[model samples]
Target: MKPERARSLQWLLVRRLILLQAGMLLFFIVLLIVVLSVVKPRLMIDNEAAVTAVTGAVDRDKDGKLIVHDTDELTQFRAEHPKVWYIIHDTTGQTARVGMAPPDYDRDLGSLLSSVDHASIGFAGKRDGKEMRPEAFVQKVDTKAGPVQVVTSTFHSRSDSEGFDISITAIVDMARKPDGTADWPRVLPGLLASLGIVLLPIILAMGVTTLVTTPAVVRRSLTGLIGTANQAAHIDFDTRAMQLPVKNVPQEVVPLVNAFNQALSRLAQGIDSHNRFLTDAAHELRTPIAILRTRAELLTDEPETLRLRQDIERLSHLAQQLLDHQSLDRPNEHRRVVDLAEFAGRVAADLAPLAIEAGYDFAFEPPDGKVEVEVNALQIEQLLANIVRNAIEHGGGKGTITVLVDRAGGLEVHDEGPGIPVEEHKNVFEPFYRVHPHSHGAGLGLNLARQIAQLHGGSIAILNGPWQGARVRVHLPLHRQTA
Candidate 1:
């Protein structure tokens, strides 16, 4: 539940989400590319065929005149159109062929007789005459212009046939019309099929991945929430607030959890203060109540009854002191700026008579003019009274009690008594902690003084003085400088 640990978990969750998204994007991109590449070529081929069919008539008209030229010219034109071929034969030696020659004809025009008795025409060669010798041949038709023959030759070319003399064949006749048109309906079906082959699996995978990761993420979130709750559960009322992880948590939950933690902290502080107050209050009242009870019990005897009444009166005064000590623990809102020097002078004058009775010297040395501090006047008076009383009672009844006030708004009460040991310095501020067990007064005096100092945003420290005595330093901020 620590803030740092929560932040780390949140970072991890973010990374996982990023990785999942990236993986999905990468998978889809690859699938799209593959589907498009496969389907694109077939689409291109179909488009090319459709364009060729649409422009076929235009091509035939543009090149029709070249086919009607002289036999030689027609033969030359046919040679240019190597994809088409025609054969012609004549009774005479000369024969004209149109288009490219067949695959097996010789380069030389030998055995010129085309058709003496019979002739054979093939992609490889043309043969004529009684011996059927190879010769330049052409396809002849009996037209209005008499028997016209277009002459052309054939040549050998490399073929897949191994070691055989293979020749090029002009099998496709460009003069012939194409048989069919392109099927446009195939476009949509083909596209859909390609998409299905490629995109469908990818989409399914993404869905599955999302489903799987959802539960994992939810579980992780729940686990983190539970962990935080468990840690909050273990928080001790008197201890400091627990640190909780804040990262990776849902935005909806953070504020509520944080508010709960803050409330718990405040509650713990209130409870600790209450418990300490109760314990100190009880301890402070015990001695006075015991004295009152003992004095009341002594009333059964006649001679000791009057002396016991005096003791009861003194017990009543001590009980009132205990009540005042309890009230000091509860702060009052009334505050004002008062000069420390004047304050110290008044407290010394009031306590001087008591010091004289106890055979102790009391002196008050205030700063020149005024050293103002923001404080509750009554509380400061009570604080000074407690310090003066403790010094007189514990100073061996003869040493001087020096009250020094400074312009810095600091006050020091120095008593010429054996200084407190350094080890007990911190403990002396604790409520009901007494340095001398056999001392007359309850041990709430110094602790109450410290509580008042703290309420005014000040502090008190016990240190060894230049002489063989204990010096109590009270440091309070000036009136204008509130902490």
Candidate 2:
């Protein structure tokens, strides 16, 4: 399957991280709004308290009415809280007195103050087990002096059976212009500035955190995936006990890993069954063929008896090739370093007499130095025997068969016979595949040789030789150090 690079596991992790940061940013915005809402009420309470403290500090008579005296404390209080104006009024709606008012303080402040209702401003009750309290009456009024914003509150002190009112006027210029127009210009920029100052840092901090952690977290999560890939790459069909590890693997890929292991198990079982069938069948056929060969030899040295003996021997060789092919499938338990040049020379010497009897010349060319390789010695011997035997049986003429070895553990068999066609070269290594239908040999020889070569981490290829012959070259890894 082609990988979607943009949608990899790390991409998904980074996307999720960004989404989480976005959610946090949204939460921060909500919290900021909540804080601003909560703080608004506290600011109103502070305004009310400042007004009340200044209003209550005025000199008072025994009857709790204002004594109409201005002290240094009152002047300082008025200077510190410029937004407040004081008013003394009788409950009977008479003209009121003002002290420390702004020059543009509306002359109509008295009429606007008299219109206030104390009972309407005292909003308090218990409803549904919840208490509600109202702080102050804050309002804007157009006065003859100009326009003014006022927070009207009454401060009352108690005497026996009598009450007096000091109707205080706390102007709220922070909410308006001198014309009492709504002062959104002053408030909106400050509100937005505060929100930006709070939100930008939070966003930058979260983005950096996501960038730093997403790759590490994604890599940590894929550790099991990398391990599973390595296991699949190195799986050997000869062994059935190996399996991918489940511990510490991610839950998302657990099922895939389990499925791969199950597939490996099934494949190993099938190969085992095939190898067993071949070995058993070859063992079963060998005895009958051996008896036939013995019976033909016992008959006379006539041409008919000699031909029959050769046929039986060919059958015996085919049976042995089947056994050799089956042996290649078994896991190699003993692989030791052996001299490749000497091994090839010995096998070639053993097969040279057979080639001589077949009206051919067989030669062994050994390398000057030892060519050592790590392999199962029995399988390597079988591989050399099969290649030499193929050349002797099907060279198409009484030509020379030469076995050459090199220092790199490479072996080459060159025969002065018609080379294989290029189209059939690859197919020649398949079991039971033959180039010539009338050839007096089963085609398992080359196939068995190929299997053994592969088992030893080597490869074999058939090509046209330098002479008018076919060359089978086997390239095996050389063992630099003896084991």
Candidate 3:
């Protein structure tokens, strides 16, 4: 099964913020409608249709004065509300009146125009308590002739049964004709269509702003965590008790890093204790093995005694190999630059006697000039000794063994005996792996040599030599910086 993809915190936060912003926008729209229904602003007017109807019907005559041209829209307004009365004043001081006022409202066009100086519309100083605002306001409109002032008065019901000011929605419902039933689809589309067009830009800008900025905010908030993660990549067994520093870490993440550090400390201590026990055990067995070997050598030349000596010697060799493996793990020793050819020759001379005693001729071939490398001298010597000893033990007890030191900071050892098999080449470097079953030597020599070579930033390879025996090659870096 495929794993589910992980969601990014940055994008997740952006999406949630956008959703919250949309919700807030919706809530405010509802609240505005509720407040408009309850507490009406004194200036809110439902006069767009009247303004458009009057302005669109007037144009310039031969005298450049406003005159009605009798359009269909004006006819419709008159048909919808039979009580509509309007007084229009063009820029040229020309005026026109269409319908008559009621008998009780005996104001002329001039008096009605002058009465607009104050906000309240009243015949004397007071109106009947039932009506607050009749459609009596001075509105300036744009016409083809120029600017014109229009004053209108009409009575439809501006208030509901509870005397709360009616909303534009209720006013529209009241204006529906004939049977007094409202057709909302006919009224709402033109007025409410612009609401979505106006809101579209705001929603897009909000979502885009969230998408662009949330990742940066999340990244800055977790900068310390990112640094800690980079440091965690370098952790390994060689680091021992290394712990992540938590001083600059965020407060919410401190506990997790602290717990990880504690776990690393415990693991390091456990490995250290295990290594210490092995080294101590190897040290303790050396004395007992030597004593038993000495006693076995002193026994008479019987077959049982000879077998006992060989077993004791083998036991002693195994313990020494264990000690060597443990000791090479510590790389704190200081290293110095030395000539590679001179060092290899010295190591070959020291191991030549052991090869001669095993009935093999030993030879050392040095490079033409000096090849230099930075290495710990004692450990390099032990590595060379282990490789030559492997050749002596497993080279079928016959012809010449050659140690060639390369000028390019490497060494090659070749022996003239039955060669190692091609398939077993890689397995020969594994610990406790022996090529010939009856061989009396411990099988950790090549494994230890390979470890030491890698510690110095080098490698080892086993191959078939030209003279019918296994060839072992070692390569080291040329003058590496010491740690």
Give candidate 2 misplaced runs (Cα > 4 Å): 1-7, 16-62, 66-213, 236-241, 298-308, 463-465, 481-483
Best of the candidates, lDDT:
3
Q: Per-residue lDDT tens digits of candidate 1, residues 1-483?
A: 666634455446556765677577767777877997788743322112222222211111252222233344434443543333333333333333334544445232345533332232333343352232222333334443334343433322223123443233322112222555444465556655765786667756666676668667777767767777777777753235555665645677899788887887777678668757765776777677777777578567676786676566545545555666656545367898877788779888988998888798888888777888878988898888888877876787778889899888789888887777788888877776778887665677788788888878899999754677778889889977532
Which should have the higher lDDT, number 1 or number 3? Answer: 3
Order of quality (TM-score): 3, 2, 1
Candidate 1 accuracy as lDDT = 0.62
The most accurate candidate by TM-score is 3
TM-score of predicted structure 3: 0.67
RMSD of each: 17.5, 12.7, 14.1
Q: How do the residues 1-483 of candidate 2 rate in per-residue lDDT, one tens digit apiece?
A: 998756677767777887788787878778877997788753334335444444434344565454434556556655664444544433333223444432223244456555653212443566457533323343433332222334433222111112433445444334678898778988788767876897778877887788889889888888878887777778765556578888768898899889988987887778778779889999999989988877787897999888888888888888888887777766686998888888888888888898899889878889888888988888888888899888887786578999999877789998887778889999999988899988887998888888888877889998653568788999898885832
Descending-lDDT candidate ranking: 3, 2, 1
Candidate 1 lDDT for residue 476: 88
- Residue 138 shift from truth in candidate 3, angstroms: 3.3
Which of candidates 1 and 2 is the stronger one according to lDDT? 2
> Ten consecutive residues with minimal summed lDDT in candidate 2?
153-162
* Alpha carbon deviation, residue 466, candidate 3 (Å): 5.6
TM-scores of all candidate predictions against the true structure: 0.49, 0.63, 0.67
